[model samples]
Every structure is written in C-alpha cells, then in structure tokens.
Target chain A: MAPQDDNVDAVEEAMVAEVEKKPIATIVIIIAMQTEALPLVNKFQLIEDHDSVFPKGVPWVRYHGTYKDLFINIIWPGKDAVLGVDSVGTVSASLVTYASIQALQPDLIINAGTAGGFKAKGANIGDVVMVSDVAFHDRRIPIPVFDQYGIGARRTFSTPKLVKELDLKVGKLSTGDSLDMSPQDEAAINANDATVKDMEGAAVAYVADLLSVPAIFIKAVTDIVDGDKPTAEEFLQNLVAVTAALDQAVTKAVDFISGKCLSEL
Target chain B: MAPQDDNVDAVEEAMVAEVEKKPIATIVIIIAMQTEALPLVNKFQLIEDHDSVFPKGVPWVRYHGTYKDLFINIIWPGKDAVLGVDSVGTVSASLVTYASIQALQPDLIINAGTAGGFKAKGANIGDVVMVSDVAFHDRRIPIPVFDQYGIGARRTFSTPKLVKELDLKVGKLSTGDSLDMSPQDEAAINANDATVKDMEGAAVAYVADLLSVPAIFIKAVTDIVDGDKPTAEEFLQNLVAVTAALDQAVTKAVDFISGKCLSEL
Candidate 1:
C-alpha cells in the first residue's frame, strides 16, 4: 500500500478506539423539586459537588455521580411554573433543560417527578406512568395557526423494550402551568385523553427534541385530577406515597438504561 | 426659635424642594411582545438606548422616553410560555422586571398587552379591559400547604379614581403559560369570572407587588376565548385591530396617570 493509505488506516483505527474509550452512557435526570429527587439521590448515593457553580443568583440545586459505568446528573430547577412565585413558567424549564443538555451532552434525559392523574382514565394515586407522548392542554393558540407554530403536540418516545420489561403503563401526559383545575378544565382534560398532568414535562420534552436527544418521563401519580378535594390538599396528603412509587420507577429506568440500552449502544 | 432650629428648618425646606424637583412619576410598561409595545413606543417616540445593556443573554427588548411629566419605559419579554423556545418562563419575567425595577425604580407599572377574552363575560374583539385582580388557574399544588405558600389571588389595584375616570371595565384577569385552553378550561375560566386571559400578567404583577409598587393590567381583546376558530388564527387575523385598541387603551392609561393619578400623588 502507498504510504498515505497506511497513514489513513492508522488514523481511522485511532478514531474508533477513542470512541470506544468514552463513557458508555451519560444520563441527565432533571427533577423539578428536591423532594421528587431524593429517592434517586439516596438510591444512587450521588454526591453534591460544591465546586460546581450555577449562574449568579440562579436558585437551582444540582447533584452528580458515576454509577456502574454510567454518569448521572440530577438538577432541581429552582423556579416553579404554577405558583409564579420564583421562576418564569416554561421558560425556566426550557432554558435550564437546554443548558443542561448543552453542558452534559447526555445520551438520554429523564424527567422524573410527581403528577396528578385522571381518575376517569384509570389513573390512581401512587401509580407510576411512563410518558410516551406529551401535549400542552393549556396552550390554546387559536386554530389554523396553532399547527403552523408547531406547539400543538410535542411527542417523545420511550424505549419500548424497556417499557415492556418494566411492565410500565405507557400513556399520554398533558402539561400546563396551572395547579388547580376548574370543573370545565376537568372536562377538557378528559377530552384530551391524557392519563397524567404536570407543569414541566412538555417544556423539557421540547428542549430534548430540539437537541436531538431521547427523553423519557417517569411520573408518580400523586393526586386525582378531578378529586373532590382541592389539589393542594390531595398533593400534600399523597406526596409520600407517590414519591415512593417514583423511587422504584426511577431505579427501574436506570437499570434499564445500564443493563439494556447501554449494552445495545 | 434658636439659630440651630432655623438652620434645621432651612435644611428641611431644601430637602423637600429637592424631592419636589424630581420627576413627578415614573411608569414602567412591560408588554410581552414587540407587536404589543409598538404603538406605545411610537406614540411616546421612545428611543432605543443602545448603551444601556441588559444582563448578557436575556431575551428582552427595551425602550424608554419621557412623555409630559412622566418617564415611560417599555419592555418586550420575547416569546410565549408554551414553546419554551426562549428564556425561562416566569423566571425571565421576574428577573427582567426586577432588574428593570432596580434600574428605573418606576413609581408604577402597567402591564399592557392583548388577551383572549371570554365572550360570555361581555368581551368582544378590540375591546379594552382593565384588570383589578389576577390569579393563576394552572398552579395546582395539591397540598394542604398551598395556602401557606400564598400563590393564589394576587390582587393589584389601579388608581381607583383614575379607573373610574377612564371608563374601563374593572374585573379579574387570569394568567398562565399556555397560549391555548381546552373547552373545560374555557368553562372554568368563565366560571372564575375572569374578563381576560394572557401569559405574563401574573408574574409581572407578582414582581411589582413584591417590590411594593402598585400595578394595573390593561388588556385589549384580540380573540374570543371560546370562539369557534383556533386562537392562533384569530390572534393573527385580528392583530392589527387588537393592537389599535391596545394603543388607545395605553394612551388613555397614560392620560389618566399624568392628568389624574400623578396629581393625586
């Protein structure tokens, strides 16, 4: 072979070797609150890296660690969309998710949290729902233009094999900034056929889609969407139970990624 | 009186004179879009101060000028909450509003924009509505601790006498991140007796309230909330008409402030 051909072969071999040497998989798990993230933190024994700094005045909390050949990061975006007390609504989630994606360049993103389920759709308290698709029930941009804006249905797929192995319920989830739903909203939610609802999922999914990363949502049902009691009352009462379910689902998800998805990769 | 008393009296009079010499009123008008702010910008002949920089990477547009005895500043927080394409949700609004408040220290803030109004509540396209109270319909915490968090029923009063003089409709306005609403949401909104619905109003009001400044919302109806057509189509089609109404409403609000509210102050 010519000298140049020999050189090219050597370069290609080095590139392949370099690729193989990199971490097998990196997963970024973004949780909205610390309570929702505690299970994963404890389970993984993730350490809070005090050396890392967020932008000045940003209130988010973050933790990270390596677990069995996989790198995992958890960020609790400080602002709440529903209360409008601390952070801007979907904007904070989008920006933080985007920044997290940019910073970590993860292979997968998992948004783990608690949600209110629709009883009419067989969603009950403490049930873990694996989100297959997400749409914004509250995003009511008027018709013909809504499709053009491309904000109508933001869809994300989970690892179907993992879903089957875990025996998870795959369903659609709706996201909005409101915490309490009026009777009319309940009717609309029922019509949408969403099994669960939360505030941050669509925004996170939208960011993941933008970055060409696979994203999955694992939400524990904390309350009934159409319960007779106020949402705040229900959420407080069931947070513990829901969080326990969330803990199990997250562990399963991590196991699936490490055992199944990473081996394939 | 002694010589010290006379000297103190002179200083007191000078201090009062200095206070009187400052601008009588400073008004910060925060609009969510450039389109919503254009009329006020043109009417006031606001010049873009290129030298005044926002914190790096904040997706907000700014303009400022003096009109009559009032210093008027306009800010356009780019994009909506649904897409999460730019900036974090209410965080952006809160941060930008907070920064603007710190920089300008305006005596009053007016959130002027367009909204989806409920026709059942006597709303029509291009009609102006003055907001007296605001709430978050989507902030469902579902916990008994919610009231302690106090994320509900944020109330802001317009200059009551000025509101009366302007002949504006005083009613509640609901704010959320979603640009679209479901049928059930529409019914719930109607039930809440909210005259108008829009994004960013509550966050802005929340910030203003935190800063101990009075705020008012002046919204021009761009579309009917429960109209047969989609909201995006309606918003686009009626942009011009709605903007015209917004322009008129803003002008009247400014007049009330300069001619009536400021005089009271």
Candidate 2:
C-alpha cells in the first residue's frame, strides 16, 4: 500500500463519529510557491513529485504527512493566462486535479493561488480574498449572447453556504482563454464590471459541483491589471507576508474539517 | 484536388453572389427527427446508404441540394426531444451547429422538424404549426422566479419582417430534454401554456440572434404530448402532404438564396 494512501485512510477510519461525520482531515496546506517548506508545513513526512495529467508541465504531487492520519496533495498551474494556455486546457487540467482529489474523497476542497486585482478601488497586493462566484469567460461558442455553452453569463453553483458564512468580501472574477493584458482588453473587461482575473476557479467550481464536493478558493492578489501606480518589484515584495499568513489559514481549515488533529496530528 | 474538396469549394463559390441574390427564403424549416426520410423531400433521388458523421447510422442524406447549398445546409442530429430524443443534447447540438452555420455566414436559418403538441386543445399528427415564441420550461440556474432560462418563452426573438409577411399562425413552444414523456409531464407543460414541444428551434434562435443572423424556423406537428390520442399510422399518413408542402417552401428558400443556379463548370 502507498504510505500516503494508508495515512489518509487511517485518518478517515479513525475520525468516524456520526452518520453525517465527513472524514476529519489531519492537516493539508496549499501554497503558490515551490519550497523545501512542504515538510515544514505538513510535518516532514515524504513529499514526492508526480506526473500531471495536463500536458503543460504544470506540477501535481502527493505528500505523505508526518502524522499517522494526514497527507497533502499539491498542484501548481504555472503562472497566469498569458503563458499561452487556452481556457479549455485550463478547465481540463482543473477537472483532472479535482477528480483526482475526489477519488481520494477529501472532506473539503481548497485551491490556493494568486490573482490579478482588477479592482478599481481598495483591493491591493497581499489581501486574502475568498471567492464567492467564478465566471469562466472567453469560452466563445461563436453564437448568440446566451450562456447555453457555459458562458460567463451562466451561473454554475453558488459558493457553498458554510464557506460563505465566513463573510469574505465578494467580488466578480473573470477568466480569459489566455493571458492578454493590453489596455484595450482591460478597458473592455472593466466595462463588463469584474474586479479580479484568474484562470482555475471556474473549472474547479464546475467539476466540484458535479462531484458534490464543497470548494473554498482563496487568492492572494498578486498583480494589478496594468495600474498606474506601483512598480512590479515593489508589489511582489509583500508576497512573502501573504503566503505565510495564507498558509496558516489553510492549516486551520484542514484541522477544522479533519478532527483527528483536534489536539495534534 | 480531392473530389469532395472540389465539391466543397464549388458549393462555396456558388453561394457567393448567386447564393445571395435568390428571393428571400420565404420560410426556414427547422427539423430535428431521430428517424426520418432523406434530406431532400420531393426530388426523386435514390439514396445509397452511406456512413455519416454519426456512428449510429444516418437515416437521411442530402440528395444534392442541401450539402451543395441548394437550400442552405442540412444538419442531421441523431436525436430529438418530446416524442423523439434527449432535449438537452439536441438543444446543445442545435446551438453549436447553428453557430457554425453563422460562422459560414448564412442569410437565413429555419428549423424544420417533428414536435409533440402539448397544448390542451389536442393536436393530431402531421399538422403544420409556426411558433412565434419559444420558452424552455425546465432550465434552472440560481435565479429568482422573476428570471428564467428562456427555453420556449414567448416572443423570444424580434420575429423579422419577412417572417411576419409569411403570416403563419403563432403558437407557443416548450422543450423537454428527453423523449420520455408522462401524462403528468404533458399536463404540467400544457399548464405552462405552450402549444407544442420539439428539440431545437428556439435553441437555434438563441444562438442565431447572438450572431446577428436572420432566422425563420417552422415545424410539422408529429406527436400530441397530451393524453393518448393519435395513432402512429395516422401520424405517418400526412408524411407525404407535409413533406411535399415543406419541399415547396424549401425550394422557394433555395431559389431566393441562390439567385437562380449559376453557370456550372
């Protein structure tokens, strides 16, 4: 048996309480960066890279946690939309990752990533924001304006209520088929009224809803959509603070869902 | 050049100006039937069974006009809703096909097909009906009751000037996603006040409008969605009358769109 597989099942088996008791997760934290810190976060078990299903060299790997009943799965979809990735390819990757997670049957879904702040006001780099809705744009069916083929105008599933209760400030987000940050495109999008841009949320939302799992997506505002103000380096300087804090939040979320770590894993 | 490739370019060339100068197609028929006759209605063309894009045997093939742009193009979907096939699949397929047609730049679009009469007034088989507006009864997306997905909804389109001149009787239409029907489903649909049920016209309209194309879709009443009434024999009885009349109308459309056949090579 795979050591990681055994660890997850053990936690799930040990945490059975009531009929509705979803498996108590040991603890799993998702990060946007690659660092030797994987062990530092999940207790130095064994973290190994695995083959990703998407052709784009995106990374996905399973981590064996130091605790007897916990393991973490990590996936990295390298940088924003302009890396020449199509929306279909992005959705396909997200679906495979979500399905892989479902096969493991985790109690909750957490997607950790960075987003471009299209905010006209207050939102700045390093603010942790919870996504309430995800709109997949650029899926042009070459037809009318109707959302018949899963356009942004079509709402998939509302963010789950339990997660919504966390009272995160809501924002409308859009995804382009590829990374294009020209002024004209940004102006047109601002005209459409979305405040953030990201690639993976809609795919995560689409498949997770189909599989009956609740997904909680958190993003660290990484880039401003061609704003007039700050220099790029000045903006990224705050990322370390955001990643460290976001990691703590992910840990709390994992522990709350998986009771085995009620005291310590 | 491959003969089929040569044929395609010839058809494309013919459609250029000669195709545009034909009299405005008086009526566009939208037909989606699971089992039906060949594409050309009254032309005494012998049909040699050929493999179609569909794996499960195409029941119909164009006797030269449709695929060659004799009338516009012929689309054969393997399924239909109401008394025929799956509603959602056909609806989705119709949307995609029509979108591609628009991409090809059509001057007109008509949905010609079989539909179940779900009106309480009780329609028998083979009656010709023109739908003014169509609404989709069962599409739900987190919206309040004040909002709907507009399946068979009334007056959904602007109903172009030429269409009004033809002066066909107006009827309401609603579509279900499956061929399976129940007396109660019939009753529910009847109560919603739609006069007929079919798979793809309104859906076609939804996308056609997005592409800014003029469209006219007409259907032949094939099944009564209400309580048990017409027999299958009675339905097939008018097949000749319906097909012949439809053939005439389609010819006029071809003539209008083709501006009289151009000199052939």
Instruction: Give the TM-scores of the predictions, in the order they appear.
Output: 0.62, 0.39
Candidate 1 lDDT tens digits, B136-240: 655544444443233456677546776777787777888765577755445546655698987767777776765556678888898887779777678778978
Question: What local lDDT score does residue B133 receive in model 2, on the 0 to 100 scale?
Answer: 71
Q: Which prediction has the highest lDDT against the true structure? A: 1
Interface RMSD of 2: 18.0
User: Per-residue lDDT for B14-70 in model 2, tens only?
Assistant: 765574455442223334542333544334242332543221212222221342333
DockQ values for all predictions?
0.17, 0.02
Per-chain TM-score (chain B), model 2 = 0.59
Among all candidates shown, the one with the greatest DockQ: 1
For model 2, state the Cα shift of residue B177 in Å. Answer: 26
Sequence-dependent TM-score of model 2 = 0.39
Give model 2's share of reference contacts.
0.00
Scoring only the second chain, what is candidate 1's TM-score? Answer: 0.82
